[model samples]
Target: MISFEAVAISMQGRTLVRDISLSVMAGEKVVLRGRSGSGKSTLLKAVVGGTPITAGAIRVGSLAVVPENIQRIRQEIAYISQEPGMSRETAAEDLLLPFTFKAHSGKEPTAAQIEAVLDRLLLDPAILRQKSATLSGGEKQRLVIARAILLDKRIFLADEITSALDAESKDAVFSFLLESDHTVLSISHDPEWIGRCSRVFTIENGILREEK
Candidate 1:
């Protein structure tokens, strides 16, 4: 489970999230919807330990997202931002980049696994050889998601990943994520995306409010 109690986040002396508490169980999909700059993305970043909390507590499963436990928490969760950073030139290399890290070394997936994930996302196998910079926004989004799937992460924090996807691609991506056993905390404004969530949260003036 993911739990946040009395969580408050302040950056540069300005509070972006104030005393927010939320809980989401495994396999539960939740979306945060609100006007832009309303702290939706900030809350997601806080859960993943990318943003420091000024107060309160955060726990993902039994591991708390404190400075001491950050490494462990990072290993268990996958955070996808709107613009994914790919250091490699080719798509396949980008997908396999994590394995190059010491923690994931020697766990690089087989070619068959990569192909299977791309196929599931409706991406052409030829894209594997394409330059990452040449791909469109929608293609990049799908590729990042495919990489996350190959890593076998149990928790996903998605920030407007489908904003640039077409209807068919969006459906394909959503279908893949929803079918997984992972817990999801997403920041999205798309109506279809919001409708797919099991729970909805809204943020206003740094306060979190459950919509349903």
Candidate 2:
């Protein structure tokens, strides 16, 4: 489970998320919806320690989202941004990049697991050998999620991941996220995504308000 207690985020002397609080249990699916610049993405980053919180605390089970615990917490959670950031060239390297990190070292998944994940996302198995720069937006998103799942991550922080996907790919991604055991905290405005979530919260003026 994840817990946020009076969390707030500020940047450039301006507040982005203010005094927000929320909790998510295991296997729950949540979506943060708001108009542009409502700090939806910033909130997600705050939870993962990518953005510094000005106040309050965030905890992923027993691990807290503090500077000292950030690295450990990140190892247990997968964050997929709206723009997948695979470096150009060496798609296989990019997919296996996380395994090279100290936290994930010696945990490289088998080739069969990789192939299974790609097929589940409707991606070509040969994509692993292609250059990362050659992948379409939808393909990149799928790849990121596939890598996360293969790592056995139980928590996901997703930011507009389905924005560029076709209908078929979008549905596939949605089903994978919701059907899997991973607990999802996503930032999205897609009607379909919002409808599918078990909980939805609207962010406005840096405050979070649950929507019925």
lDDT for each candidate structure: 0.86, 0.87
- Tens digits of per-residue lDDT for model 2 on 78-141? 9988778997477788889888888789989898888888889888888888989988887888
Compared with the true structure, model 1 gives a TM-score of 0.95
Among all windows of 10 consecutive residues in model 1, the one with the lowest summed lDDT is 164-173
- How much is the lDDT of residue 162 in candidate 2? 81
Error of 1 at 143 (Å): 1.3
lDDT computed for candidate 1:
0.86
TM-score of predicted structure 2: 0.94
What TM-score against the true fold does each predicted structure earn? 0.95, 0.94
Candidate 1 displacement at residue 94 in angstroms: 0.6
Clashes of each: 0, 0
TM-score winner among the candidates? 1
Q: Hey, what RMSD does candidate 2 come out at?
A: 1.5
Error of 1 at 66 (Å): 1.0
Backbone clashes (count) for model 2: 0
